[model samples]
Target: MYNIQGYFEVESVNEATALLAAAPHLLVIAGGTDVLIKMHHGQIEKAELLSIRKIKSLQGVVKLEDGTILIGSLTTFTQIANDPVIKENIPVLAEAALTMGGPQIRNVATIGGNICNGATSADSASTLFALDARLKLQSNQGERVVPIQEFYLGPGKVDLKPGELLTQIIISPENYRGYGGHYIKFSMRKAMDIATLGVAVICKVKQGNILEDVRIGLGVAGPTPLRCPEAEAFARGKTISPETIAEIGKLAVKATQARTSWRASKEYREHLVEELTQRALKAAIVKAGGEAIA
Candidate 1:
């Protein structure tokens, strides 16, 4: 049972923003996957919820005239996994979406909620980091765009200001174009489990199997989802060989600040970061039309 104080259903961004401005204590709820569970556990008591589920503008996937992809905040994991535009332009995100929980959960878990919850283990975080995604935040005052990397303040925390809501997730063409990407979630179980470690790799392959560029993102490895810049810098302009991948894997470990938890030991998570980085990078290389390294 929830200790409810109030519940407000909003129909548009403007309405939601106005409500938020008036009731700063109101917690924004979309899918309620994380919020309801917390409320049920007494983590949140006497909570006032402002539901954004009825806001149509905050739903669906759209490709803009500039070729950028705009994913509305309320877009579900199931919708992301099956969307033709997402699959064609950013299949890595789709793959991550499919690995989240089970079918029923995916159908109701909005990407907005997942991101707003600010969990490092969230399946989509690493992929979004790798893609250099940006967030569009709106308020009754106005709107602003923030780079995804800057959005996370700490574990279970984000940079949402009072009266502001995440409206859309934006991925520019320069980030996804010509890049083949892959996401690997390391968990104890194949389903209904959070990632102990998640790895996402995106790379562009040049002639003769050289890596034109590469980006690696890791989740549950630090206070927030992080990119392995050292490894990415090392891989850029390097030939995609077994030796190169091995070195890159080791370098990727430097980016992690993993800590022991009930789900995994710090050492074990580090091992996954290294090993899975190699595997994910290899798969991404292949997807980018590079030869597979044995």
Candidate 2:
């Protein structure tokens, strides 16, 4: 730890941004789920605090004047998971929220907190990647909307400036159509455990045989949440049969090998991603009014 400090809970994004620009290395706090853990464990550099929890504008669900649904950054995971609008409009996101932490964690931890942390295994991000989520960054300078896939620069990093705050998540109306999705996370236990591996697969089913617009993204399988376009292309338009699903699994492993460099060799991770992806796809297919392809 670098040093100690008190909290400054600013009520507005502009206020938070000004505070951030002034502080040399302030660790922004929201919900305090992750920060408090690091503060207790001495894992994070010590610094002054800029808390965004009190910013009310950052805590609501809004369907904009346009058709896009705007999810406020400070909206808790529980809010997302339980919101009927979210469940009806973007159920995959709601499903992802359910897997975040325990109920208490879901109550306090915010979506902004998850994205800002930028961990590869961040459950929210992996799901969002498949949804083609867009993030809004607000600052004293201005605001910018960045596609979620491009928002992350590296692990524990994002494309944010010193005075920037991720203020909103935008999901387009086209993405609101019902689809099958599964977010499977591998951890030691079911609750309150970080994922060792996680997979999210979302796709539309057509004519009971063809797979259309398939998306496969992984958590803890890359430096940032990654979509396997190659795997997706190979899987799309294919029959949802077991042999075909297995082939898609293999392609997913091939996609991972193109990027991952592992000391343990890519075999195990590839296997996990493939297995998890297949399981996830099976679950999703069931939800999409189809039986598992056996």
Candidate 3:
């Protein structure tokens, strides 16, 4: 049972924002994925609870007039994984969603909760980062959209202001138009294990030989989900040869500052970053119907 405190079940976005503004120590709960666990362990203290799970506004995926995809904040991982539009366009995200915990967890865990938790090993994070997703945050004052890459301040920390609630995630159409990508989560076990390292690669292929554009998103290899700009730049306009792929892998490792953790050693994490980066890139190439130069 949660500690005795005030509770608010907000049914609309405005009500949620108003509740947040009034309760300085209020904690928002959607799907209760991360928040309940913390509360159970007594990790959360002296705070009123605000439940946004019933808010209908934050519950589905929609395509905008301009072809951008808008995913409501409360959409569950299961909803994301099985959504036809998501699978058809940005399947890398769906694949990532499938690898998060088990069916039960995915069924209740909202994508908003996952992103808001801001874990370094957040499953959906790397894929969304590679897709160059943006988040819409709102408060009583107003709303603003922020690039996902800038939303993280550090491990277990985010840029969300006290009364601000993340409302939606937006993905530009250009990212999913002519691109293929994959998310590879390396964990001790296939299910219910946090990623030791995760790599997401989205690439636009040209003529089955060259890469037109590339984005590499890394997880559990740094303080936040990281986009490898240097490696992306290096891969662009380069023939996807064995040597080029190898060099890009090295660059990805160089871009990360992986540390020794209970799950793996620093050296081992670096090795995974190098090997997985190459594998993800190669897989993306194949998915894009391009052949890596041998």
Give the RMSD in angstroms, all C-alphas superposed, for model 1. 0.7
Model 3 misplaced regions, further than 4 Å:
292-294
What are the TM-scores, per candidate, against the unseen true structure? 0.99, 0.92, 0.97
* Total clashes in model 1, counting residue pairs 3 or more apart in sequence or in different chains: 0
Error of 1 at 18 (Å): 0.4
For candidate 2, the lDDT comes to 0.82
Best by lDDT: 1
RMSD to the hidden true structure, all candidates: 0.7, 2.5, 1.2
What are the lDDT scores of the predictions, listed in order? 0.95, 0.82, 0.92
lDDT of 3: 0.92
> What pairs collide in candidate 3?
none
Candidate 3 contains a number of clashing pairs equal to: 0
The digit string of per-residue lDDT tens for model 3 on 1-294 reads 578487888899999899888885788989987998888889887657889999999998998888899999999999999998898889999999999999999999999999999898999999999999999999999999999999999999999998999999999999788999988999999789999999999999998889999899999999998988899989999987999999999999888989998999999999999999999999999888899544
- Ranking under TM-score, best-scoring first? 1, 3, 2
Better of 1 and 3 by TM-score: 1
